[model samples]
Target: MARKTIITCAVTGNLTTRDQHPGLPATPEEIAQACLDAADAGAAIAHIHVRDPETAKPSMDIGLYERVVELIREKNTDLILNLTTGPGGRFVPSDEDPAVAGPGTTIMPPEKRVEHVARIRPEICTLDFNTMNSGAQVVINTPRNVKIMAEIIRDNGVKPELELFDTGDIVMANDFLAAGHVEGPAMCSLVTGVKYGLPCTPDAMAMASRMLLAGTEWTGFGIGRFAFPMLVQSWLLGGHVRIGMEDTVYLGKGQLTAGNGELTARAREFIERLGGEIATTGEARQMLGLAQ
Candidate 1:
């Protein structure tokens, strides 16, 4: 029997906007529709991040999250929901003073960061495990805050999709698991190709994968041009994969992707061609021990 590979479609990250990619889902309706399309295209999970309907900036508004979750559940109940807690971690230093936070910094207390997850009670939600310089601003998730965030998510009975950017992030995630802040078998996304973090090089990914705890359900993705390539690499190395506009705007050199569905469809092809089969939602749920 072929090993089943799980494909997670990160429909929209908080970074890109309508100006950068017009197809990036912004409003709740658009994001909900995008997840539906991804499910139709064979994604087992739809990793989501909501934006302001009017402005399209990342938002922590519980109302927006509720609507989006309501929409997705109302339409397709099988698709796994993975809400993001990554938006509230930005910290930009004052270029002038360098002591105080500069403009464009959005830092929330750990509980506030995962407030929607506690309320909406999704099957999975991202818990970013590291702080790194993401080129635009400093991504800050301190150890103390992460412990708090992990405890909250676990209490809510939502799985933390351990978002790891580098080698050390895996250790911290393991600590969370050991401390029982993260319950049961954990999942991780080995993020690469970001500035100041691990690049999309094969060795970097291999090292990061090796760092993960045994039996941890893990996925890997590289932003920009390395996105699809990392999908292939991750599947080949005995793991699942993630794709969509959140990780890359372009499908190829000059080809703009149609939407999250398009990326999801191609990712299925990559996994199948690698001699692996994509997991259905039910099988994925069993593998991850998600609540039915």
Candidate 2:
């Protein structure tokens, strides 16, 4: 039998705005409902990022995260939660004083980055394993900082899903595994197509996949136009898949994606037609060694 493909829907991301897609969930209720809809439509895991309700900007506030998690659990969905520790890493240098951080910077200590993860104790949480320039600003997650964050996640019994933007990230993830910061049977996400990271191409995806630690359970994703293509490549490459408006706003060239559920249903079609069965929440937990 072909390996089960675990479809992970990234409900929202840090940088995307309402102008890009009004349907992008901003409030806790909307985000929770989006995760449920994705689960009902076929996603086994929901990768989440919360927003500041008033400004619609990404936030690290524990209150917002609590509300989203509470609502999702109260609804009693089967989706495995994968909260992000990716916020509090932005670093935009000031034009006047390059030595100082710009007004956009939100760099926080390791404690703040993993605060929500510790409080909510999700089944899985993202740990961005490398620091790279993202658009105009730099996302800083040094080895020291990452180690601290990983330790917190591990201690909480929450598996850390390593977010790899390039080969260097894979190297760091391996180091984390070997040093015993991250738990065994590593889980990683091949984050391709960032302007400063690996290009969104088959060769790039394959190369990054090849660099995964032995026995690593991994998935792959791309942004915007590259999203679906990466999903196809990810499944073809013997990994899993993730899709949603967080990664792309369009279902087709000109057509906008309706919601996370719609994108997830489309991903299920590709996996089933390719002879790969979609994994259930239970199966995904087993594959990733997530707790019962």
Measured by lDDT, the strongest candidate is 2
lDDT of 2 by residue, 1-292 (tens): 5589999999888877889998889999999999999999889999999998888888888999999999999986567999999888889999999789999999989988998889899989999977898878898999999988988998998988999998998988898788888878998999988997989999999999998878999999899899998899999999999998789988899998889999999999988887889999999988998776
Candidate 2 stretches with Cα past 4 Å from truth are none
lDDT score for candidate 2 against the true structure:
0.90
lDDT of 2 at 72: 94
State the number of backbone clashes in model 1. 0
lDDT of 1 at 34: 93
lDDT tens readout by residue for model 1, 10-93: 998988877778878989999999999999999999999998998888888999999998899899989998999998888998
Top candidate when judged by TM-score against the true structure: 2
* Candidate 1 local lDDT, residue 243: 94
Candidate 2, residue 189: Cα displacement in angstroms equals: 0.1
